[model samples]
Target: MDKVIFSFLGTTLDAGYSAGRWERWRPTIALCQQEDMIVNRLVLFHGGGHDSLLKLVIEDIHRISPETVVEPVRLQIRDPWNFVDVYSALHDFVRRYPFNTEDFEYLVHITTGTHVAQICLFLLIEARYFPAKIVQTSPPRNSKRVDKSEVAIIDLDLSQYNQLASRFDEERKEDVSFLKFGIATQNSRFNATIAEIEQVALRSSTPILLTGPTGTGKSFLARRIYELKRAKHQFHGEFIDVNCATLRGDGAMSALFGHVKGSFTGALQARGGYLKAAEDGLLFLDEIGELGLDEQAMLLKAIEEKRFFPVGSDKEVSSQFQLIAGTHRDLSQDVKDGRFREDLFARINTWLYSLPGLKDRREDIEPNLDFELERIADQLGKKVRFNSDAKKSYLQYAMAGTTEWAGNFRDLSGSLLRMATLANSGRIDEDNVSVEIQRLKARHQTINSDLGVDESGNSHQDWLELRDRIDPFDQVQLAYVIKVCKQSANLSDAGRNLFQQSRKDKKMSNDADRLRKYLSKFELSFSQVKEW
Candidate 1:
């Protein structure tokens, strides 16, 4: 690093005022000297301070750099403050004592207050007396006099600063690849769907509405649209996702259209609201039906007119965002009930695409399973493979209609993650599969019982009584048994099917035992139940 000449131009009040707190300046002065920068002179622009404290700072600087000259200039200013005069005085001092290039490689103008700093910087920039670098130095907020001069420096590289500003402006451009669906699919199936989604995205500029059951990758589809649009240069914006359920009443309006300073009790600064921030990008409103009527009205107007007023402002700000909304609810029913706005519903309904539930897409199960397993493996930082027996067990369980995947893709992903975590010897086996299956079945049964549904799909009078009698372990065992019995329609044939499904020689005995236990629980022997 080249030797730099640093100048301190700010008041004691700017450094923060308290009794005996002036000692903090010593460490800061010492830091400047220790750097490749040489301190040729120390100028103290004093506002109001005891002469003893000023002497202490000067003496400390002298001890660190003996050849350094100290010049103390007393400033006469107003009591409360006049910012214009303060800026003029600082500007005058810099012009009068012009820095010689040979004596200083760089000039560092340090300030404590943002207002004072901004004024001083503006003056310097206007006069072309700007330093090679402007550094903001301030004491840590919480500390005693013992640890005073802990400073944080922010280097304002004009080029990099401009780049960051540009990035903020271009923040709406999003990479959709980061958003992935949890379902596993075969290579052929995955590629085909992605290609179709890309085609739809390319052809349409209408608001895309993704409708599906919860956890069926509605959000993922929205992100894919954003990605496809970005890739095709259809829109140079980013994807801003907002779960409408989280934004309630005043929060919803304030979040969508920001408030001005002092608009509300806690409104500190005028912020660019989400709509403004998402300029020209895709705004993903998840659970759109959950938005309050007032907010829905405002959102509808913005979507139709491309403008909205901030919470406190009268001026309508322009918003040129692509609207992508997702919902699990039947909005048409909501409209009929007068809960959701019919007008807003019509706007989003323009280009709606409903996603099929995972259960409806059994063909995708195998591929999605593999994809989720790979994802889980990557997350756990481990390498795992599904053993043939484990894979078969998983397929049978998945293909069975007993387990209703209420959470859809998300539930499948979680199940795979748990299996990945518990896999032994880097391979998931039938025992682990059985254990996971039983656990999931137990959880689902509890949930179903709470919803007052019995095992045979009948409404129970006492759901609690039904729940007590139903064993999740037995349910899982019976589901496997039912799958085998349905496949062969004979006890001996079902046992053979169970053995084939097990994929392990040791598992054959366990399979036979499980089969018998499953039959006993149903209160029927193989001969009585079997059609063959």
Candidate 2:
């Protein structure tokens, strides 16, 4: 019996089948089923689609490989198009299903479109999913042939695909670099802070706790640490990020540690949890403060002992992952309130760093704004420039207002993106600045109230009122003296200004002495008083 393997690529399951692309797939499917041939098992992979397509692909594989075993893998790729998920799914599939080329003679990949095919090719080279020869099935540009069998097979070696994948990865990596530290981009403060955090990441095996206001770049910093650590050493492990808030009660334990088959009502098969996925790499717990007290206790044990038993499993699994925890809440306060474990807090706090808010670093605003604008322009595929007046006005507006930036870097990036979209000729004017500032004030009014300021303007008003309240007498006296001197200078037509208004105008020399005494009380020289 012959053996054949097929990988189907498409935007969605139905589209690949309905567009007559399934015809090309049929040839590979038929080849795998043929007895006395060089084919036996048929492997099919689907990408990015509704579940209906996945079911259809599985059914098709079963129909083609009745005598031979059929293995089907469907990757659930998240939108906003993150390739990490695809790589992870493919790698997992390869690990579980190791193929023997001696039994299988042909391995074919049927591609739906350019991008889907390109990513799969990249994953193959980087992940080394299979040792079989790789080929791409490209449709004829001007032909009306809609059958999968009509698809052209382009033979490609590992090196050629590897180079292309490397270039693709490099381009993406470069783009992500802007999201990294000290790059002239939106959220540069967060990026730079994250870069600094990464430096200390590898120094100690202790768990790290990143505390900051929401959207202050906690997750970003954690990811950077993982990337840095991965670069420092060749660790074949995954960086698994989990939101502790989402994992309530049993779900928390199930997600952290693996669950045995029939462990719970929905445990159809034994599943490895995030701890197993992370292995030798970093496991980031985002919003760690939101974890319930019971869940916290479980997590603390895992951190301290580097082991956790799966839910409903008697066996203890070793999880030697580098724990990177982050939270927007004050964990110490949570501990005092008996909401968080003190021991857990102490363990994670061994390496702690607080990120400064956007308001604290006003100097970075202009540069960050420029970098964000450039990014927005590049993404929109349009050229944008800030007019001199608009630029000055916007900067002045940014400087004058005390925006706490409750959302921090994320909020700033969003505001800049909106401004760029609405700006005329890429020029954000004073009017635009004013409108955006008002919007920001309205958006954060509750936060402002909590901080004891109704708005930035109100803060400025309060400052003026406080100054008046503190030195009411001094202000009144200074104004009165300055007014009198001006009047005297005008009346006498003297070359020099008057020192002060005499208490007794008719007393002449007596009044002069009194005024001199008054000047001395205020630590003013007679000559200086005259100048004043």
Candidate 3:
């Protein structure tokens, strides 16, 4: 295979007005003269008015190596120092030049060009505008002869460097851990999801939607994503956080897209809102589903086009920012119910990541317990540790299915804070954990006693009084049966659903009587349950 090198013609270095030019080694001539690194063809690029120098260098290269081919090409660049002109000329030449990797190996000679020319060539080579390795030549230690020149070839492909590749892998893992709040989370699925979220947050500026129940770390993860991107220099502006639930009517509009003076009855002063403040940064609208339809429409316009008219202002304002939305409510359901704008929902739903609640992630509780203690130490300036027995006892109760973890991470953090605050000196003993467990059990029972509504976050006030009197275990079943009764037309309809599978074995399925007997256990009648 023929070995080819592309290089710029250094007019002064390759020129010889007299015999004295032979004293200094010329890079182009030396590249061809190196016995260890043979060059079959040289494509020498030079600007106009360098024909004499170009000819002299080519002749010198051929004098020492008779078999070497000298291919002199004129770039016609008025200024070799002008990057734009030099790059454009070289780019066109590269496009037109025949590249056959199977028949030839190529190298970009960086030793002889002007600084600007060298930079252009490096940029083009790194971007793979042409396929080649970079070859650099330097002056020999004690020689000025072309035959003694030093040559170094560097391959740009990173996969070839094992140590550097391993370093990058380690950095990527550290970034993933950052997004997870440095938690040693054990769930495989959750870890994989965090990895995906990390990648998406870094590589894209699109709107990211994080969905989960309350206290599942939607807001925390959103802020972490912002922090990660900011640390990587992806964002330059501030982190704008807004809870949509706090926004209402004119106030919501004013808070999001600025408001001019006299915008409303209480428009005391002009305001620059979150969207503008988040320019070149990230805006986390926690509980984004709580946004009113009008605000949603304006937000859609602002997010889609980066321009919007603020409240009571005819002039349009512009801002460019990244949007990350967090919602505990099901946005798809909000769109169906006409509570949220469908267009806005679709726009922000491009990268949706759902976080699992604490109850669903039992394995992570232990690690989070340690993390909470670490946080407590940081906040209170007092270090605390759980004894082995206390830690084991707490983990057992926390991992059990009976533990609701209603507020998820917040609830866990609060529980740990209480235990740590009450710990004897710096040690949490077994007795402390038992008291905490009983307190958590009582808290969960209180939460269950009011579990009268279905999954849609509705409330049934009538069932609350009856629910308060029921045992924690019985509250769930009674609440579900009451839900069916409320949805049913009458006693028989409710009875059939309540005894669905059991009625199949009856010779004469008196479902009403069976349901009546069941309702008596709760001291409730169908008519009363239904009416409520």
Candidate 4:
């Protein structure tokens, strides 16, 4: 069966009764001739006063085609200029209308309504309150005769447009690249994470928590998200980024919630603060874990109420700002430790993302290296290039088992900066590569010197890395054995000292044998730790 065509009747002089009678110069009548397919029903919405004109319209529609049923819906709307009344009436009509898409298709006539009514109809259909296609009616250009001959059906769904879809895809890609600062990253996990962040940023204004080690770009990512939202017309105010760790004592409160003049000794002038500055925009609080308990309480209120009072002020100011928090500390652990507010953590924990450290995403190192080189060229106003040998040598040492990127991307960035600065004549050769490698090794070795490890330098320096290589029980016991060996003179002496307390329980008391076997569990010996 064909679907019903729903439309609003505009009671203008042309559509109204003229000369004390009906006129065949109606748009609905002319609408019938332009149709290629049969219309099951024509539902017209009109005011109670337009009953006579509606009867004429129905008669004309029937005269054109007896197959089409005309249904006139009586609504009590006195003023079409009152958008609320007209929209509410139409909304109620649509809600009460029996919509069965399986049995009948639907079409909404965008024409033949007041301008306000037309806008309401468009909004309702776009919101899916009316699941129907749009049909527009046009009268004859001469204005003397009615003509629905110029009619058009517009499809709202844009997926049908191939070129438009391609354009949208390209826009999304550019947004992702902007977030990465045009790094052209290669890590699959990292790429997927960026895409997810973009979607959340575009659609929501909830508090987002970015947790990662220092120098993982949490602050940078938050700023990019703000820019993306601003570009999409989601926000308009300035992006207020605060390093919460730097806020101290009364300064924290004064900086975040503002302060009235003369609130404190140094209060020279009244300030609007970060929240007000970020009104209808984004508030990025980096190192959120460092915020004091009082600050956290005030921040929670600002987020929940969108209103807060500044220091020494009774008047409440409003700021409906979006929040993004960055942290290196485990907030849940802080909550348990009584250092962070539990409620604040719970509120902002809805959208949490843990950015991976550089060591964890070694696959992206090559591309990042190239990105840094370009960044250096941009910064110095002169391009620099690494000789083939230098590039290959740096990559080898960077990816070696000995390398521990404890500081993650920040460390890599600094290393590149140093190498670029020391490059002779804008070119990094083998000499430059050799110097950087030695410096990195010296730094890493100095940091790890205190950790008990192989004196022969044959094993990985970090004992934490061996946690996966052995059983939990063996790992603990092996660490203790290594510690004892470091303090003792020789293997027998270290073994004897370790078993001094528990040796009485043994049947055959061969202390060295027992210690040897225990050490062997971790593939270690007294010589390794003692020599170190």
Candidate 5:
């Protein structure tokens, strides 16, 4: 490959009056005479009015190294010591220069420019404007003639070294861990998504939307992103988190947009809204889909303009804060249904991310359990550990396909809190876990039954006749069970899923037989009902 060097003319080092110049080495010309490195081309940059000097250096370079080609670029720099001027000049030169890395190995000579120029060169090189290592030349040893000046090449690529590479890799892992609340989650997709969230949190100041089902860590992740940005000194104002679901009516407007004194009957004093309170910081609007149409419209205006009028006030207040919104609602659908504003959705949808629920991320349950236990230890002021049998039993049930984690992480945390509080001598034995499992089953069953009031409008003559056969009280539950059956792969699968919790207590191991017996009472069979 052809060797090319970019260097600035050393006004003092390259100055020579006679043949004695061969005794002293100039960096711009010294790099060309090296035994191992060939200067196939030299692009020299210098301030104006150095035509004579440029002439002498080109002729000298050719005399000693006849094969080297010299190209002179006259730089327009009023002060080489000024960072802005020197950087602009060099930047323009690099921008216009034709760089063909495949055909040539290029080197930037940092030994010739002023300190400011050297720093600018390093910055541009580090940013990868043009790919090249830096060449630094110095005078030779005392006994050796200056003509034999030493040359050192420094490559800025850090990944070539194992230590530096590993350090950066480990730091990135830590950032991802921080976003996950330090849980050692094993889900590949979840881990990769968290890594991307960390990057976006640190790099972008625009709004971020985190969507997931309730208790799926949407709010938690939003706060973690805020903290990460705060730690990086991205913003200094206080973090203001408001759950829009709890807000309602004009009060919602006043709470978010503040109210001037005497704005309303209850407006005893003027208040600075959350937006103004979050100046230069992060404002997390959790459950943002709960905001009314008017509130959403005003919020969109505030987000885009950074200015909003207070209640009953004409003057507008300005705030510069980053926004991170969290919601369990499908906002796109909400937009279509006229429940949410499309323009507002469009503004915040750019960096949207969906967090998987605990049911969807069953592989992470164990680590999250571990994390909860650590928190329990802190909260209750006593360390707790589950015995071998208890942990095995709980994990089996928790990770089972039949288990429905409708409440997501909130359910797990509450369950852990109860068990830890009820532990015997800081140990949760098998019996303790057994009782907790039964309690959890009843809890989930009650919730499921409450939701079984069949509004699904399943109206068929056979179904109506079958429904009339059962008690009015049993119709809701029977209908829900049938729905589950229809959605399942087969009778056994449906029964196994439906009776998973109750199966823990029954002595008989046959879920299918139990389901069949119940169905017989209703004069229905899985094969016949599944078709309906």
Candidate 6:
């Protein structure tokens, strides 16, 4: 590969312009002589206002080494100290420069120009605006030593440095911790998943699909990923997050793909939608399973083509944005049921991570208590603390097998907010913990009770009481089945509804018989269903 040097023009005003006299050695020229290897070309950035100095520098480069090709780039800027102006000018200049990384090896001379200009160059390099290494030049102590000598080339690849690499790893851990809101979790699998996510966020723009139960922090993590990417200057636009579950029919389509003026009943003006709003940024679709088929088709097209036509608009609008989708529902199952598009699922499934539910990451619960408390304090302007007894009591109950956190982090957050609000003198006592625990239990019991209601308004609590009676997998499935049963007029109706889509592919003679036998395994029947 041919060597190419990218450097800024340093003023030679310090050196007298007297005939047959030179005070200082130019850093750009010195950059060329640092190593024995010949630099094939030089891409030099110069202030457009300084034409004479530029000419003199070009002459000096030719005098020192005529074989080296010089490409002078004129950048207009009033002040080097004005970082915005200098950086913008340099950024535009480099962007317009046709760079072929495969054929030429590039080196940025960080030694020349004002300190501000050097910093901007370094930032551009770090942000990968150019594929190059930095080179710094120093003048010899004895001015009489006119031969350009002192120079050091800097390689910004930190992975090569053991100590610096370790420091970076530590900082990455901190970043992951911040993403989790300081939840000091010890679960190895969960920690490893987070580490993987961190890598994906930094390295790839591929659509990420976060799958997990509701309130499992999928949306939170998606937003955090956007923040991380934005902080790194990977994205310049705002993060657009939309919960797909709340969208319905025309509203869903319009909100996602936008609508033209007079497109629908209420679209009075041309709407830009979430996609256009997230141009050059990130779009996090929480509960992505709920989007309608037509919307999904359009979304698939947009993801692939980076352009889509707004409703009732002939013109196609373009948007380039990273996508992060979150969902509690099994999209594969949805695809099989013909509710979700298989093509869309396949497109987003490339970078999929299943975020663990609160039950799975129980170790994180304790630290989350403090996080919640701090969050509440900031919002309410009142500080609160869980006393020793209260803290132990709450943790014990929360960590126990009976305490099913159905709502996951949302449940934990709500529990802490209530306890903190009810605390006496800014301290939550054992009584407060006990009351909150009982309240949570009642709320959960009420939900389970609703699934197993009898004719006489008795809470059979079949699902509630069977906490440790059956396998957790069976327990969850059966609970859902029973819940559906409560809404049906009869066992046959419940069975048909439950297997409405799945039974289509099966040669089943009696859906009711199949459901009945399944219920018998759990000692449940239709007669038990009424009002929980």
Q: Which one wins on TM-score? A: 4
Which regions of candidate 5 are displaced past 4 Å? 9-36, 47-69, 75-91, 114-116, 139-145, 230-237, 251-272, 301-320, 453-532
Q: Mind giving the per-residue lDDT tens digits that candidate 5 earns over 343-441? A: 999999889999998888999999888789999899999999888889999999988987878889999998889999999899888888899889988
Cα lDDT tens digits, model 3, 1-532, are 7899899888766667577766777777778878887788888887877676777777788888888898888886878789888899998998998899999999999988799999988988888886999999888988656569899999888789999999999999999999888899998878989999988998999999999889998888888988999899999998999999999877889999999998899889999999999999999999998888888899999999999998999999999999999998988988899898989988999998889999889999988887889999997789999999989898988999857899999999999898888987889999999999999878766675476444212355766776778796787787778778877888889889888877787744888887788889988898877766
Residue by residue across 1-532, what tens digits does model 6's lDDT show?
Answer: 8889888887752123444434456577666654475878988887877677777778877877787899888788888799999999989977887889989888898887889999999998887786788877787765566455576778787778999999988989888886776778787878888888998899999999999998888988988888888888999998999999899977888899899999878778988999999999999999999898899999999999999999999999999999999999999999999999999999998999998888888888887888789999997789999899889999999988657888899989888989888888999999999999889978877876666532223346555576458886876777677678877888889889988876888777688999988878867677764354
For model 5 the local lDDT of residue 373 reads 94
Query: Candidate 2's C-alpha lDDT?
Result: 0.64
Query: What are the lDDT figures for the candidates, one per model?
Result: 0.68, 0.64, 0.86, 0.83, 0.87, 0.83
Cand. 1 Cα-lDDT: 0.68
For candidate 1, the per-residue lDDT at 108 reads: 51
Q: Rank the models by TM-score, top first.
A: 4, 3, 5, 6, 1, 2
- Residue pairs of candidate 6 with colliding backbone atoms: 453-531, 453-532
**Model 1, residue 313: displacement in angstroms?**
0.9
Clashes of 4: 0
- Residue 361 in candidate 4 has what lDDT? 78
lDDT tens readout by residue for model 2, 311-412: 899998887888889888988999999988999999898778887777766666787776677778887677566677767867776655445677877888
C-alpha lDDT (0 to 100) for residue 386 of candidate 3: 94
The TM-scores, one per candidate, come to 0.52, 0.49, 0.79, 0.81, 0.78, 0.65
Give the distance in Å from residue 302's predicted Cα in candidate 4 to where it truly belongs.
0.9
Off by over 4 Å in 2: 1-180, 184-198, 374-385, 424-431, 446-532
The C-alpha stretches of model 4 lying farther than 4 A from their native spots are 19-26, 47-56, 74-92, 140-148, 449-532
Instruction: Give the winner by TM-score: 3 or 6.
Output: 3
